[model samples]
Target: MKRILPLLLTLVMAQPLGAHPHVFIDTGLTLAFGPEGRLQRVKVIWIYDAFYSLLITQDMDLDQDGDGLLNPDEKAQLTGFDMQWVEGFNGDLVITQEGQELALSGPQDVTATFVEGQIVTTHWRDVTQDTAGSGTYEVTPYDASYYTAYEVTLPVEILGADQCRSRIAMPDITADLDALRQELFALDRQAQPEDAGLPNIGAKFADKVVVTCASS
Candidate 1:
């Protein structure tokens, strides 16, 4: 109602209204694997408003590097739209540890809760879509370190795990878009008019990035 009142008054006051709400999205995920590439730990961090929360996360290895480092072949395959590499979870996933390999079948969902208050979670469930998007990473047993990169896209939505299906409304989409354009089209701060620099009309927003995530 607080938000709605402002909108209604805008119409009555004949004031210019902005069409947007802000949803600052920040997410973090951590997963651990055994010496021989066995699933272990999962951690997730999701931030919205001025508050953020986290959950245990699960990951499917798309490719493994033998040299204990991110290899060129692996990077090349994950690059662009027409690239293919030794992607795991595309169909099957194998975790081998202590001279034994275990196969995990089907979609893996990370069940967790989101607390609105500072103490005792205000909500609880397994919000699977929070882990939406494709993630790339490799582990190095020699050093016990891993590296990863991911892109987030729409279509794949995050709803609390075990919770009933629901719809979410966001206002940040517009603000972010506008901010992006102005930032990208922004003129060089150090450039002078005599330098034939870019026009001072300000930056323009480029295209939005949309990523897809599939689990099986």
Candidate 2:
């Protein structure tokens, strides 16, 4: 299936555009634990900004009546439109334990809807690693190239694990942006940041949700 957003092509190319994030997403996360207290899955919720939502609606020919709401048929057509990810795509989510990134299965239980002129979507990702005994984990959502910005604006919930709790660690936007600007200025006029071996600065600006378990 074709992806719903064509701008994703630019994101995958990772061009050195040197521009701010064009697409904004308000992200929500729910951590699900298994009977043994291991991290089982993550339920992700994405609410796109109004402008981008409008673009998506236009691209899909949805909301033909311009009523700012999707009917049943439109909702069905919009479902899973963003789930058809390209190869090497990380789904913009990262889960790490002790600095080692854990593996996650592809998106499942995908659903989508149109609400108040915004696009809202949800999906599930199974944590394929055994994290039962791990006391702490980091979950981050970001676009490496900074093409899209993800803000953990919604509440973070822990499910099936009373001992586990989550806290959001927000980055220092001013400091991060200052550093990015210096790096960009250091680059030769003809050289792109990627060509200059600059690291993924987007990670520096990401909000990290730290999940800790008192008893595992």
Worst 10 residues of 1 by lDDT: 140-149
Question: Per-residue lDDT tens digits of candidate 2, residues 25-81?
Answer: 999999988888888899999999887787778878999999888889999999988
**Candidate with the greatest lDDT versus the true structure:** 2
- How many angstroms is residue 25 displaced in model 1 relative to the true structure, after the best TM-score fit? 2.6
For each candidate in the order shown, give its overall lDDT on alpha carbons: 0.25, 0.81
TM for candidate 1 is 0.22
Candidate of highest TM-score: 2
Model 2 residue pairs with clashes: none
Model 1 CA deviation exceeding 4 Å by range = 1-21, 37-43, 50-109, 116-180, 183-216
